[model samples]
Target chain A: MSTRRIHAWPVRLTHWLNAFGMFCMISSGWGIYNASPLFAFHFPTWSTLGGWLGGSIAWHLAVMWLLVINALAYLLYGALSRHFARDLLPLSVSAVRRDLFAALRLKLQHRLGHYNAVQRLSYWLVLALGVLVVLSGLAIWKPVQLHGLASLFGGFDIARYVHFFAMAGIAAFIVLHLTLVLLVPSTLPPMITGGRRETSHE
Target chain B: MSERKKAPPKLEPAQQTQVVNLQRRLLLRSGLSLGALAMLGGCNLQDGDQVDKLLWSMSRWNDRVQAWLFSGQRLAQTYTATQITDPFPFNAFYAEYNVPEIDLDGYRLEVSGLVERKQPWTLQALRQLPQRSDITRLICIEGWSAIGQWGGVPLRTFLERIGADTTAKYVGFKCADRYYSYLDMPTALHPQTLLALDFGQVALPPDYGYPLRVRVPTKLGFKNPKHIVELFVSNQNPGGYWEDQGYNGFSGI
Candidate 1:
């Protein structure tokens, strides 16, 4: 019942690319926020890694396009995929209850060939947060242009802080999510290739 | 595109596993470390101030690598004139009369703490030094950037004038705003950096760090503390005003 069937290539590709994109966005986003001279590396204006503000901005904007496209595709796929009901969600109420408990306890156990209700919930939460970050980012970046949206967050200055602070929250979540993925590697390949082994090591 | 890997085998081979594991460990360790650093950002770095000192060191290390091995990273590109913005007319922080005007004559930049040289220099004396000037954009951490020309002396040149030693690192700027902005000495002395008096060939604006401000090229605007009062060169980390809040202290722009 939980055997690994082949996954859709688009689904897998979008998942991994989006994951990578978010990681880069957070790392480089905060790096620019620091404004210290510590990160002159990784960035285009630096030697090491993602440290320059301008280049980091460019990279963030570019990958942001990728993330937006991938996220939209994933959302559409989830709505139309045959597995949406059977694998992604077993039932509405019971699944929501179990997911809530898992979230509270921080117990993330990835079920083979199926996203436990908790996994589905966390994934959806991250998606929502990503959207919030982008919207807030635009408000701070071009406040006058996005006056309507920026006003929603109290104004330009406040929007800037909100955008930055929300980034901190998102960065924390990303760290937790990555740790989970590494701890349970059984489920990742499906989103990269066509399908992943249910338990290649197990 | 070339950066993409083959999504590694689910349970990677030993060699591959070691590499990925190492990377994961580094990310978690550094990300959480940065997270913790930020969590305590507004608060004085716990009593030890270990993170502050570490950031000071990291500031130097990163500047060196970024400027050298990663030269492309530090290659400051010029934006088109069309990209430049002259900033909205100042409506924020109207000059409050409640604050007393800083007496520039009485002011002497004090250099003290863990240094071989402890001295002070008057505003006139600071202005007399061989100067550096630049026309560049200042990017704010709050997500805005302003392009303006700035002129003044480099803090590194000042440190050299006073005989700073190999042991010293951070350059702490004391300001009339009663705010402190700290920089690793290397960054303070970088070639493009400046301690400026003019914002685009005129007297500095009252709202825009008047009298003097530290113009660290390629840094976020927060590091540009306006209305400078003094400069201190030492081994310890001199932090920025906002850093005490949950923002990144060593914000490498």
Candidate 2:
């Protein structure tokens, strides 16, 4: 078969936007969490983070809405269009496993494959954690709606701590994620532009 | 001259212009971003009072709009007991002072102004009335929250005991630390509200406002002033310290 371009446009947008939004959230969230100051901003009652607290809250809430909307659209479109399996779910377990280890090796030869199955696995795992972040956030923010959700995580204070740690873990993942992208931009373009200039086959 | 050979010419006008234009664009874009960042970095106000009032009023307005739009639904959410830890780990600075040495027991909760009962009642007397308990939050405005069970008489019951004058419009609380603040009578005596004495099935801890404190669930932590030594009825807004220092007087949930 002739070499062809396979552009999964919806997945592409979700990939890039999720990255951008999460990056914004983590930076702003750090400011909000420490309150006194962690970076760029000073502490003391007089010193509020430049935009970390207020700005992070706005960004976090806004991006959170966007993330939810985009994820919902992706899910619904997948279900309606019968594309979730085709576009997102993996094809073969053996191939996925092999690719996962290959990605893990980070060999110079395989770097151009963009994301290996390992990357996909990590991405999916982080997405699941994102759900936890949202749930815990809501529990702490409005336990009344979910009714008793706050009590689930050992009450409001613990829930707040969980929310913060979840955000931090996701943030750490993003840092690792960006390092991968910087090391492997050939793999990055497919996410931004929906297709990559594939030079070789794995 | 013959050996020197020809060197490559400098550039085509388009190429040279493109290079210069890219530099200018890069410089301008970076400059704009820097300026914007600097602006956001500034305090954006001459004094904290200005910022505090502006933010507080804005918060109050947003709260009102949210409440109006959502109807009677609370802007804050209440939690259920599924994962709720019993005794909801009490973490606070005031815990140290909540010792038995000064339990505020026999503590007279004074009821004065526009009322039939113009005397002080001990904690024992206040507890004699019908008691109310509920699991609710201690939501600090600075951004920490807690959910603990509070036990006390409904503030309305206390008002009833006092035979509050129909003209009385506000209720002021004087605390052990000399903190003085008051609330509109309507808010002070709301049905779910209480002047609490027991926390987590034990006598109220000192720092947690042991002996007796106020629990108006529908407001920020500061509004639920702890360690109240006296309950004075009034028509005037007996401003609390924080309120006088730029916090909201209403301090609703």
Candidate 3:
């Protein structure tokens, strides 16, 4: 049997930072949303981050710096190191279709470090959503200064809806990602421990 | 727990090792859960908490950044008369029924701090200044906005008329309703900043801060104080009502 390192240090570091920062942003965002909800429902107090509206706004703005800087750093590292190209690229509808059926039958291969077609597609989608949410947030935060960005979303009022929906998309991805990790528990330890795959010869 | 403490002293060799492992595992589990709870609880900015202090400092730093980003020459977008929101919403910390009623007979807009002129000006005196009007949106912190037409003396004109120290860093307003707020000097001098006396070509109604209000299209609604009774120029930041509680002090839109 043999083993080798899979996840790199930068990847692990940025991943954890994003996890924590997103938690802060999303929880606090809910608190801010309750102040003037666009929808009929409100998030329960226990599920929110900040205790009140002012406190939530503070938390949201504070975490924004962390989330934005870390996300940028991860993108730079991913591109320079060819991580995205090597692991998550070349996604196609045909491949996704094949993987979907194979996964349903519990026959798809589970490689420790390699991504499947569905994983690649979702990663790309989440990345796009991240960009969307950030831009929408900026537009609304400084509508007068960033009027160009706000106009792209049809104005400040519409930009808010864009931000909310982007958040919802990311949240959906998180749920699916967690469920997959639990099903393939071996994938979890590797993300933390920089993954070592053991290949045995009979 | 008491039973386990007593057993540790008497357990045999194999049993003692098992007991020790059990205790260690329990301690690790509890410790991990406790850490998670603390992290979540720290999300709220508790008064005087270390996390709260750190967040406040970050907010203050952002205020500096936003101030830098603010451009005096840039203007908030203007809308046509038809685009103005009809029956604009009246929002404040208090209910509409609690709007203060000021007698126009004795109403005065007091000026102080760093100004050459100490005398207060009446509503008629304010109206005599060169006036301008704008139909612009007021973006609130609560994620809602409304467009309305405001006509009044340009704040820059008023400040210059009073011989205000142009270099002052802060312009604070004390309102008749006990609501107060302050603006960075640049915002206070912006062309769109108005000492608004008229809403939609009519004198302000009581519900909308009759007689006077500061209409700053460049700031969020809270920074545009209503029914202002006093205006002062100072180097010190007189923290605002919501700002002191936790909202960003700069709060530039």
Candidate 4:
């Protein structure tokens, strides 16, 4: 068995920072939503991040900057380092399909030093989704000033729903991500310590 | 690097136009759906007290960004009469039943601060000014929106007539309901901003600001101070009731 550097400092930093920021954003967002709820039931106050509507707005606006800056940094670093190409791209369709079936059958291999086709695809998709969430959020937040953006989403109303549903999608992704992480417990340590344990092929 | 490709032959104007439109439509549709789907994943599973401090700090930063983005010349979306929300929802810090009652016979709008005229204008005088009507959306920060037909003097007209120092930083309002708010000078001068007198065609009901309210379509509903009895133009930041309580002062959407 051998250990190797897997996650970079920037990757781990952004991953955890985003996790923290999104936590505040989603909880407070629920509080703000409760004021004029679209769904039948409201998020329980204790579970929600912000204490009240006004407080929630404050929290959302504040943490939004953190998420934006962190995401931007992650993207810029990934691009400059060619991390996307080396780690997440060149995904073969056949391999992806095989991995999908294997994962579904609970027969997928847990590689310590590498990502499977499904993992790479999900990570890339989530990255893309994060950017969309921010843009749609901006469209809803400043529809008049960002009229062109709002119109692109059909209208301001559609933009709001897009933002809402996008958040929900991200929430769903988190659930699957957590389950996968637990199934492969070693993945969590590398994210925190930027090191991985693996058996030498030779 | 790969060699650059040669340019394609130009198409006829009609054909070119059709191709461009098709591309635009495709791009718009894909962009919308992709944007909607991509933002659909992620979760935060931890609870901590320090999160509040971080959020509040970020919220203040967002306020600055929103303030920078606001342009007085731009207009909020206006809808047709048929599109107006039937019975626009009444929202406030207090219950709908607790709407303040004012003595119409004694109502006076007091003007103060950096203005040539500081006279208190009567409701009758305000009505005589050139009036305009608009059906504009009122977007609440709480995530709902409604359109209402509002009729009154344009805030710009009223401010100019009152000889308000247009260069002043802020236009502050003190309302009859004890609620108070203020607007940036540029927003105050927005062509569509109204010192609204009526809800539909009739005088505004007490629940809807009664004798007078500032109907700022460019701002969130709370920034539209209701039952305004006092107006002041000043350079100092006149913090609003909700603003003081942590809501953004320039709560534009």
TM-score of every candidate:
0.46, 0.56, 0.89, 0.85
Candidate maximizing DockQ: 3
- What is the model-wide C-alpha lDDT for candidate 1? 0.60
The candidate with the higher lDDT, 1 or 3, is 3
What TM-score does model 4 achieve against the real structure?
A: 0.85
Off by over 4 Å in 2: A1-24, A27-86, A107-116, A151-165, A186-202, B1-128, B133-150, B159-192, B198-206, B216-223, B229-253
- By TM-score, is 2 or 4 better? 4
Q: Which ten residues in a row have the lowest lDDT in candidate 1 chain B?
A: B68-77
Candidate 4, which segments miss by more than 4 Å at Cα? Answer: A1-4, A196-202, B1-58
- Which candidate wins on TM-score? 3
> lDDT tens string, model 2, A1-202?
1243344677667766666556545554554566523235433422222232443343344455567677777667667865545434674578678876765775524444344566656766787788888788776654443446877887666777788778867877878888977876776666666564365653
Grade the docking of candidate 1. Answer: incorrect
lDDT by residue (B1-253, candidate 1, tens digit) is: 1223446555647777467545533432343344334344567654323533444344445445433432212423344545456762332223555333666668666766655667777768878998867766565663555666778887667777777763476778887766677876556667666788777657676666777788875555777777787777777666555544323444554
* CA error at residue A180 for candidate 1, angstroms: 25
In angstroms, give how far residue A9 of model 4 lies from its true place: 1.3
Worst 10 residues of 2 chain A by lDDT: A43-52
Task: Using TM-score, rank the candidates from best to worst.
Answer: 3, 4, 2, 1
Model 2 clash pairs?
Answer: A144-B78, A148-B80, A151-B83, A151-B84, B94-B207, B95-B207, B98-B206, B218-B253, B219-B253
DockQ, each predicted model? 0.03, 0.06, 0.29, 0.24
- Residues A14-131 of candidate 4 have per-residue lDDT tens digits of 9999998888788778878788777798888765654566766766787788899999999999999877887788898898999999989999988876889998988877877787
**Which tens-of-lDDT digit does each residue in A31-72 have in candidate 1?**
556543322433332221133343344345545666777878
Candidate 3 lDDT tens digits, A1-202? 2554567788999999999999988988998899889899999876676666777787789999999999999999999998899878889999999998999999997888778898999999999999999999999999888878889999999999999999999999999999999898888887798877545421
